[model samples]
Target: MIQLKHVLVLVFLCVFSGISQSTNGYELWMPYSNIEDSSLTKKYRDYSKSIYFPGSTETLMIAKNELHTGLRKMLGLASIPTNSNRLENTMIIGTKENLNSDIQQSLSKAYVEIGNEGFIIKTVSIKSKTVLVVTANTDIGILYGVYRLLNLMQQHKNLHNINAVDTPKIKLRMLNHWDNLDRTVERGYAGFSLWNWQKLPEFIDQRYIDYARANASVGINAVSLTNVNANALILTPMYLEKVEALARVFRPYGIKIYLTARFSAPIEIGNLETADPLDPKVQQWWVHKADEIYKLIPDFGGFLVKANSEGQPGPQNYGRNHVDGANMLAKALLPHKGNVIWRAFVYSEHDADDRAKQAYSEFVPYDGKFMENVLVQTKNGAIDFQPREPFHPMFGAMPKTPLMMEFQITQEYLGFSTHLVFLPKLFEEVLDADTFRKEENSTVAKVIDGSLHNQKLTGMAGVANIGTDLNWTGHPFAQANWYGFGRLAWDPYLSSETIADEWLRMTFSNDESFLEPMTRMLIKSRETVVNYMNPLGLHHIFDTGHHYGPGPWVSELSRPEWNPTYYHKADSQGIGFDRTPSGSNATEQYAKPLQELWNDPQTIPEEYLLWFHHLPWDYKLKNGATLWDGIALKYQQGVDEVAGMITTWSIMKPFVSKEQHEEVTMLLEIQLKEAKWWRDACLLYFQTFSKKDVPDGVSKPLYSLEYYKSLKFPFAPGIRPQWD
Candidate 1:
């Protein structure tokens, strides 16, 4: 949010003097480069003449060290620690209790407002000296405040009269890593797993510490290290030792470690025949396991169990319900103040209901039945993470239960890491969606932050895309997805535009020329992806197995919902799933207003037209295009949008490092090529049923429908069967 004139100066300094050392994105966003604005540099230097950080705890010391590093790099000053206690031109960093009595009394109301994990970074006038203060209620908050203060400095914000006090709306902002022990990641576009299991416990990689730094910078307080497709061996003593090592590294950054508990671990590792929730031995084993984990790592977060879903073992194996399973674990962790995050991403081959409605039907009746420590984690959409989807119906339905949102930070369904899709745009849209739970404007953010439901526990979990790649995430811009996820998890209501602006300023360039167009491009990237891949509410049309390309014709999987044809019921007569009263009636799961609005195909948004109802091939769209033509045009528009991105990037090449520009240019080329692949492949396949041409505005198919159908990838990055 820097003014235009200052922005121009920053850009000029960056372009001419090479102030931005954006060589490879290995630094993530904490580059700590010299300030691009000369005026701001002097002002920051004046404030950083000396620091008064008065604490010996690890978190506090980390904040003190960060100040040294930031000041040294950005302002070219040592700003070494001094015990003189001279208030003049000093940067004070401490908890509220550690601050001077006079200042503490004046800031008591601010301290109370920020709660435990919030912090204040302000320039205060005390005893005729201009001193900047960074104070919080807890050590972790001090660390967070220091990170925030550095970030503002990184973005070249004027801190002269700054008064910023912020807190996380959600309690547990976390990254759920789907990483395995063997070094493969599920749905991971990034090269390989970050955890080197063979070298752990003894060999502590610097990457782990940097990962914690990155997460802590954005206010992510918790992490689940293992895949939800759980492995019981991870809970064993050997792996627990490894987990303990990771826990130690993350501890200083205020991140609690969570492991996925395989539902049948009692049988798999505990030498018990059954993992039945009601059984005495099974319950005892889990209690003992929790105790053992806590003994190793005192602040260990509880399990993230993905049970009774996707072939994973659960309480249903023993004819027990989810409550019985969740409560048993909850009881074990309750004494330790740990939480059991039970994923509600369940669908069954046994149930004869729509896949989208099954989670709601199964979990809604059991609302308020779960133990206090148990949190039901639900995905953003009812279905798997598609490019675009209507908000899941379960967010408002399970009112009595504490529901945490689950969003995919990886690009599993959106052309992988190759496409520069800014996912915060997608996250923002979902957060702003009104559920009409209690009344109008009851947004998904309210439900997640406990403003609407007044729930005790609230969280937002993002499936991590991190790996051993040099840039952290595979594509450089993919870093923004991880960055945006944390920012949104910290404050769900923050706009994607604001996130794009901040990320650009910190990671790439703060200049107005570079920031303005890129911000717009980043904000539009997700929709561009949506338009190309799954335009007009098409869901899960990914091909069989790898899902690397278009697969709308895919069918004949053993499970009915596993096939793309199941989602998009394209036929000679019509297309789209029938979720209205006459069909699945999934709309009935939503609130009354939504149900009313969604029942009719004509009234629903065209983007979601196919999701709620089946429509005729010739149904007239609002733009006067037929249904088939509209779909074709949207696919074409998506391709054109990516082309526009290329053009925009090409123009801004002078603003970025040559290596970065070239790397992204190559990736965007792949994205455009694939966009055409999606456009042509799907359109050609759907045209068989539509019995019409692709329409005037839409581009012609580059390849035949048969060619697209015949293509197969045997070794996509995140594939199935072996999964490794």
Candidate 2:
């Protein structure tokens, strides 16, 4: 029906407009794209035509700005006037204290259940007129509620009859940035750290503001800006000024900045003779340092300390235990109402009985010894962020102490940013793991949320994956892991399915065609990586140093725990680590039922067969295949799954942008290549031990095992710097 010149002009406009609005995944899950569904768009426009916000506080202002911005982008509406006529369909937002008396009274019942940072969003009738109200106890909660409303709109959810009451289960939902002073993040696959120390005090990067907004949207209240393997200079006046500048930027977004406290700061920066927890001079120095930090940033969240682990100096260096070190920092921070998150990830070459058993042994003994302001941070797995690991035994063991979970959002073990591994599935597996500490349903979620142990000061920390990359996280889908971590940290009970569904809708589209297949792919991704890289509970087999690729034969590390050979234990007889009573007795660490179940290879789940028992290659699995055949099949299955993902994505091109589709397609191809590399490299190397040919139906390796081993990646991103 259109003329030729009109068609040409339309094409020109569309092309130029698309160039201006092109997405490189920078918006993450908060992309407020204009709604294509006219019916839904009309409903949203009607609901948000006017606003009645009653506060002028910083957080309230942020919430107001966000509401205006999101609505303008999504509904194509200009800034809606605040405190406009509330006669019909007005969106009301404010803290309970600031709201009208009648509205505050109406929300009083719902307010009781939600704690300090909780919010209530409901469609209410006011004097015979319908209005949507977002009310909370504090300004920050109002901000959260506003973000929630935006999220719902982004996902194209119905605004009518909306009654949502939400609160964060964990008190301290935090991101532990392993970013160093030099802007090189440890185990960070993305580009350089978000913190630009060289230009900080004066030049405030807009990225910092956006970072705060992103974190605040997901209820992440705290951020430790430095690596746990800390540098003492961060505590000095020179860096404290920089950190203070950041804290000011994040404060309005309800994000409190934390610093990783170098345990030997008293000696390293203060020139003290000894960094002993018992020494008065060292204690005084820390107290003074705490005072100095609090003076600059009044609401500082406190310290995250990695002590006596991986060669980091600690109170252990001065004949003191974890309690001694943690209590000292806790005491120093107590005056400022700050908390200490002391890490429980410890292992020493000297205590080589079982590396997995060391953390529980070290911290469990000092259960009630830690100060009230201290929380012991433990990794999700006994080992370090393996693709698949049984929930750490320490979860149930430390009843008297608040054991905060430390999940790695960064894929340090599962192929970094390149691989599309959805970590929420892994996080869900650990959270839902039955600790059996009390009765049935005593989950790790319960342990960390303080319901199981009846302890206070609960928290969960995720090692941040963010960098200065244009997309924030290097890969587009890797942003899901960061989003998932924040969601889980808020409520550990949230299923991965729900998270994937939400993320896909917000980050991409609400179209069912895109959502269904993409959600399935994301949910299955972690298992795919596990199957290919560490089938049947085999773990820590990645190449030495960078851990970028397969290295099941590595045994050259000085520490036994650091060697891949120490974990797999592959030989002519079989492959696996025997951790039962007959071996290292690591099974004894778990609760009764798990101990009994894991002690026997026959009863243990086949996925963890290699972790708990050293089985023969010819051992029959539940699938009626030999262990060797099962391993090979799993590897092939993983590769096939990746292939399937590529196929799935190819068809999704119409649902997403050309750039997005192309980027993911490229990444999926890389995943397939790496999947094959893993399948071939590990199987080939293990074949030498089993002296077996490639199993039936499994693809043959293109190269020899020696050739796979000869490949090198000296400049792999995220390789731990030498100082660590």
**Candidate 2 lDDT over residue span 71-177, tens digit each:** 98887676676554444437778777756778878778889888789999998888876788998988898999999999988888887888999999999999999
RMSD each, Å = 4.3, 2.6
- Winning model by lDDT: 1
Q: What TM-score number comes out for model 2? A: 0.97
Which runs in model 2 stand beyond 4 Å of their true positions? Answer: 1-22, 84-89
Candidate lDDT (C-alpha), each: 0.90, 0.89
Cα lDDT tens digits, model 1, 665-688, are 999999999999999999999999
Candidate 2 lowest-lDDT run of ten:
13-22
Which residue pairs in candidate 1 collide? none
Number of clashing residue pairs in every model?
A: 0, 0
**Per-residue lDDT value at 339 in model 1:** 96
